[model samples]
Target: MTRATVQRWAAFSDDPGGGNPAGVVLGADDLDETGMQRIAADVGYAETAFVMGSGRERGIRYFSPVAEVPFCGHATVASAIALAGELGDGPFAFDTPVGRVDIETRTDAGVRTAAFTSVEPWIEELPDATLGALLALIGLGPGDLDPRHPPRLAFAGNRHPLLVLADLGAFDSLTFDPGEARTLMDAEGWPATIIVLHEHGAGRWEARNIFPVGVIAEDPATGAAAAATGGYLRAIGAVTPPARVLIEQGRHVGRPGLLTVDIPESGGITVSGTAVPIG
Candidate 1:
C-alpha cells in the first residue's frame, strides 16, 4: 500500500503542544479498515481521522490504536481545520458511521477554528450496577458524586458516562487503574468517562476525560465528550436552552485545551475549538 500523508493538529488549542493531538489523513478512500487501523497505531494519537470523497459528500472515519470508533470530536475538528488549510475556509459535510456531521471553519488573522454540529444527542439513566462498577474502577464512592448533576449516559455520536464532581480538588486528583477502566468501558460499551466540575461562574466547567478503551489513559481535550456533556446538561434541565458553555480540559494533565459548546433549544449540539498544526 502507498503511504498516506498524515497531518497532525492539536485540537481545542491554538498551541501545538496543548490540547489533544489528532492525525488527519486526507484522500484515504483507497485505504481499507486494516490499513487505517495500522496507520492510527503508528500515529499513536488517541484517534486519527480518515477523510474520503469530497465536497458535501465526504466520508470520514475515526480509528484509535486499538479499534475504530463511530465518531471522534477532536479528530473531526482537526480534520476540518486541516482541510480548511488546504481548501480554504468554508463549510464541510461529513458522512460518518453515526450520521451526518456538518463542520464550519473560519480563519481570523492567523487563527483557524472549526465548529461541528453533532448528530441529535440523547441521554439515558445509568444503571445502578454499572455506576457502582465504574465508581469502583475509579476509586470513587457515590458520595463523591456531585448532587447538582446526576450521573447519566449521554450520547452524541458515541456514548460517554457523565460524572460530575463537587470540588476542583476531586477533579484534579483523578486516578484509575487502566486495566479496570478498560474492562468496565468495554463491558459498558463506553468510549470514555466524562468527569466535570462546575465552575464559579455560569456556563463554565472543568473537565477530564478518561479513555482507557482507546488505549489512552486520559485525553487532554475530548470533543465528543464535550458535546455529550452539553446534551446531558440540557436533558437534565441543568442549563437553559440557547446557552454557550466553556469547557476547560487538560489542565491536570498539563495540555490545557479550551472547548466551546453551543446548545440550542433543540437538535444537535455544536462544539467549537481551534486547531493548530503540530510540527
Candidate 2:
C-alpha cells in the first residue's frame, strides 16, 4: 500500500476548537479504498479530503469514516487551506466525482480562506410519515417546526435533509437519540440532517447536525446539508429571487462555521466557506 502524507485542519473558524476538523492528504493519487477508509477512521473526523493532480489545478475526493461521498464542503475548505499553506494563494481546479469545482484561496498572514462552488443542485420531497418519524427520533414535533419553511431534502453537490424549527426556542432546545437517528437516516437515503432556525429574514439561517455516527452520534458541521438547505429554501419560495443565503452552524459544538450559498432561480447551487489550519 502506498502510504500517503496527511495533514489536518478545521474549517470555517480560526480557533481549532471552534470549527469542524477534517483530514487532508495532498497528492493522493495512489491510495486505494482500504487505505483511504483506514486513514479516515483513524483521523476520526466527520470527513477527510484527498487531493490529487498538481500544477495550478488538481482533483479532490472526500471520504467519511465509512464512505466516500461525492462532495464535502468543510473538507474542501480544509483541503484548500492546506494547499495554500504550502503552495501559496490563487484559484485551483478541484476535480471531484460530482464535478470539477473551482476553489479560490485568499490568504492573509497565515490564515487561509477557501471558497468553492458546488456542481448544481436538486431537491427531494419529504413525506408526512417520514417527517413524523424523524421528529420523533429527534425528540421534536411538527409544533417545533417553522411554519413558513416546512421540511425538505435539498442538494448542492450532495443530498441533505433540512428541518426548520419555529424559533430560537426550538433551536436552543435541541435534543436527539443518536442511535435511533442513525437507524432512521439509514433507511432514508440521507447522510445527514440539518436542524435550523432561520434568522436572516427568510434567507439566513442557523443550523446544526446530529449524525448517527454509526457507533456514536454528532457531526460538528455538515457542508452537504448546508448546500441542500440553500437549494430547498429557493425551491420552496422561502428565499427571494436574489437569494444569497448564509448558514451558521457548529457554534453549539464549539466549531462555529459560516456557509455562504447562492441559490439560482433554475439550476445547481454554489456553496462557499473558509478554512484555517488547526495543525
Best by TM-score: 1
Off by over 4 Å in 2: 108-111, 200-203, 214-216
TM-score of every model versus the real structure:
0.96, 0.90
> Scored by Cα lDDT, where does model 1 land?
0.88
1-279: candidate 1 lDDT, tens digit per residue = 567999999999989999999999999989999999999999999999999997645999999888898999999999998888778898998999999999999988878899999999999998999888877777778898889789988999899988887777766776888887787888877754555555546778988888764457888999999999989989999888999999999987789999999999999999999998899
**Deviating ranges (above 4 Å) for candidate 1:** 192-198, 213-215
Check candidate 2 and list the clashing pairs: 18-255, 19-255, 120-268, 121-268
Weakest 10 consecutive residues, lDDT, candidate 2? 191-200
| Candidate 2 Cα deviation (angstroms), residue 156 | 1.2
Best by lDDT: 1
Candidate 1: Cα lDDT at 65? 87
Predicted candidate 2 versus true structure: per-residue lDDT over 146-184, tens digit per residue: 788778777777766677777786677778877777778
lDDT of 1 at 168: 72
